[model samples]
Target chain A: MGEKIMVKGTEAIGEAAIRAGCKVYFGYPITPQSELTEYMSRRMPQEGRVFLQAESEVATVNMMYGASSVGVRVMTSTSSPGFSLMQEGISYMANARLPAVFVDVVRGGPGLGDIQPSQGDYFQVVKGGGHGDYRLPVYSPSSLQEAVELTIHAFDVADKYRTPVVIFADGMLGQMMEPVEFPDPVDPSTLPSKDDWALTGARGRKARYVTSFDIDPYKLEQMNLVLQETYKKIEAEEKKWEEFMTDDAEIIFVAHGTVGRIVKSTVKMAREKGIKAGLFRPISLYPFPYERLAELAEKVDIVMTVEMSAGQMLEDVKLAVMGRAETPFYGRLAGVIPTPAEILEAMMKEIRR
Target chain B: MSEQVKDAILLASMPKALNGKEFTYCPGCHHGIVHRLVAELIDEFGLREKTLLVAPVGCSVFAYEFFDVDGTVAPHGRALAVATGMKRAKPEMFVLTYQGDGDLAAIGTAETIHAANRGERVTTVFINNAVYGMTGGQMAPTTLLGMKTTTSPYGRDPKREGYPIHMMEIMRALPGVAYAERVKVSRPQDVPKAKMAIKKAFYAQLLDVGFGIVEVLSTCPTNWGMDPVEASRWLEENMVKEFPLGVYVDKVTEVMKEKGVK
Candidate 1:
């Protein structure tokens, strides 16, 4: 750890992106994540970078398409509704194979819901938020420091795979402050050039073109196949999760992001009560660590899922468990965050059955 | 044929800014004409190496393959927004957006208005063909009143389909706009004037002035259900009535006059 400083999750992400060498940021202001945009606006231009407040969420994502096509590191942050509006651009960028980072500080959704923290966008983010056959490598962080680390790592993974990466954080994380050690700033000038496909001016070379329109069906199919192969490589190499005391537990709880942090506390409380409980947290949600969860599910008597949404990620947990154990979900819907005590009670109730 | 080719001398060949590929435009389409004019202007200004074209998702979606300069295709109606990002990030690169009527005046109206209002150092070539050619002749926002289209089979009614949008007039009113012109490519005489208007727009960006736009009255012969020759005549007779030609804004010239330069 370097010099420790306290920052909100949003601020931590903004600083991390700068450290990760993001030179361009285009975003529209929204609740929960506005601080990230605000910080970028104030600091990016002063550092001789581009920070533009787009006219709308739609325009903001399209701007990323343009910036990334020029081989520049770029990022954007938004809440739920704004994230929804960006789905079309996300699909386009995915098809065009442009790399950029997007952070969704999730709030209660299904409409113009409350601006409070929620995990409702799990299905949308992990199961392809946009149209077509594509996936974004998603990261869900449990703390401010982890958000910073994962945010910095997101840029690397996105650039490596040439795919968009989404940081699936919640409003609670965005608003809460915690002590974090900042990483060393990356020299943007030292980054590798993307001349292989970037839309830099074609002076003495063949013109570089970036587009998703394939009029021929066979060619489109081949393009989709290429994307799928890349995704398969990512899944084979990048499935990450953390298992806490799951080796000797009879009952396990699966969760992620802010809810996972709460479940960790619940596991400690349940252990003191002589309940053999452990927590399984998935750090990468899209290429989820299902194999580890499946192994634990076979050993445990029950696998309980906890979340801030009604029960979106519960389906994934159940799918991983594969009928090896009793899979039950307990959640607080529409921005209601459950306490550790409430989660313990639900776990006890489910284990009793 | 070889003797005739030799006698022609190839004095004025295709502009090098254009890739050596045959156009995919339909017969009598004005996109071909506008593409040639823009390519010649890019060649004339020696911007072939520093230009980036953002083509729209209409009939020009494949324009990246047609231009020998670096280019990308924007989503439907988002050409200006993408161009804004490119220009702002790489100020040394001259960025341009090529869009049609539906893209500029309808679905992308917000992007078009906001980019010009911000005085982004970019140029936009608006091809107002008055119909959606790619989607098979739907009524466009720039379609003249009483014009027949697939969506307006009974002829467009002003109360129902709305009046033709004058992009040049609208863009000229923005203070950040340095130049705005409405030109046509219906006749051989119009081609030179159209090329001049396009070159002026490109110059606005090269000089780092405000945003510039050139609205070209184009034709969609197949969509208009007319032959190539008849479509040209129809545009000269009808389309010109609602969208008149000439420069509507010339703030670059105004500044030059103020500075007593040219």
Candidate 2:
């Protein structure tokens, strides 16, 4: 709380994860997120931790799954395409109820689109990217300080729920530098022991099994029911968002991550122009603060979403609004970021319409 | 009842490592034998309490049900990679992966190669049955030339279908591998020899040597359209030609000699 220093977004996230008691980091080099991997490779060994440059993203995520299965703090960082490759492993972890953190510094995508920030992976992350009925508690941080705080929070959330948690910052947050203060380092020994479910040699006890395969249809359905119940609990307890000037506002701007910060600036711009505008920033994508958005929709005349995608989050926003308000969307697709002026212009037009 | 009990004398029995569950493999399948050998080694090494097995996705997907030790199942061809994760995370435990040819030689080729290349101190028990057992006898990466199966109805042609992948030979060349062997359990005489090879692979990991694998040449009679006896004979007569038996790597013996372990 007292210290301040300049740190790259990726480095801040990595350091914060370390301070949160992460003992193993397995990752491959990928654009916009390579600095995070490099940071771990340099710092983990100093902390007496494991830092491995895996053969591929496929192997890296699987490695993370293995490490996490043993009840250890393990993680991996990747960009969009690499995260796409990690989908199978992520599903496996979720199904096995293994706890781990995954950092997706999302870049332009659909297919290796470009190396720039994009909230394009919103659906892929918030919605399940892999097979099965699974959800990763997604954290979208708007700044380097938020990235640090969210990363530490990610591990705790993952461990507390015994499910995989994701930090979904895009390229802009990963590559940009900002002043941040990391929390005090955590002692790995003090963390909860995974002996209950981890593969730590079943000495003097019944052997433990970790797998997602359930051949019987009835049994598989029951397994999914169990997972769905967990998701319900998460939705009930973990929905987080920041409301800015929503009171007395006629038009509300819904955004997250870097897009949310931009919309905050645009809200000021629109206010200066004598238009009533406010910002709604969702911190958690999955377990999304949909109820709040719904509440705000009833009060606001227009529910607008601004994104760095064609319009992924708009689907969720509209679903939340459910025709309570007129839903309008503005986005710059394929790695193009929306400026405050462009967003303000869109907000003004929405108000005028 | 006393007289009947007296008449029953046990010569050899199942290893204590088996959980007494019946195998899900088809009749005449060699997975039972291979599983027994692994179980025997687990019993012999006293690794039951300290062993973690990674079961692969083929016919042996239910292997965790048979082994008494703690276990996990990996996606197709990713058992070794998963084992690498388990072993790295818990180095005190002895980790072993049971994978079929399709899982180890085909889709998991990259994982198998890299786990070996990185020299993860783990043991791999590879079952090379030359056919995809669980999915109904499709042509596998190790499926022999001219072999007829569900996918290769016209027989596998080397030019079109490619030759059987000799995995032990391929893995032997990797520096990370401390020991690699291809053994067969086609006949009664071969069972003990195969068991010995599997034991050596386990010892390699216990000694912290390197990655070790024993590619067991197994039979899939249900897929091959042969009875148990015929399948055994067939493996001896034909499958042996494609995947010749013997050690492909032997640093375990070298390490044992250095440490004065007999």
**Prediction 2 global C-alpha lDDT:** 0.89
- Expressed as tens digits, the lDDT of each residue in A1-353 for candidate 2 is 55999988889999998899888999999998999999999999998888988899888888887788777898899999999999998899899888999999999878978998888888889898999889999999999998888898899889888899999999889888899988788877777776777877778888889888888999888878878999989999998899888998989999999999989989898889888888999999998898889999999789999999988989999989999999999999889999999888887777667
i-RMS, each model, one decimal: 0.8, 1.0
Model 1: residue A244 alpha-carbon error in angstroms? 1.8
Q: Give the runs in model 1 whose Cα sits over 4 Å from its true position.
A: B1-11, B254-262
Give all candidates' CA lDDT scores: 0.90, 0.89
Q: Clash pairs of candidate 1?
A: none
lDDT of 2 by residue, B9-105 (tens): 2115667788888887788888998898899788877889998899989989999999989889998888887888878877888999999999999
Report how far off residue A63 is in candidate 2 (Å).
Answer: 1.0
TM-score of 1: 0.97
DockQ of each: 0.78, 0.73
Residue A96's lDDT within candidate 1 is: 90
Off by over 4 Å in 2: B1-11
* Residue pairs with backbone overlap in model 2: none
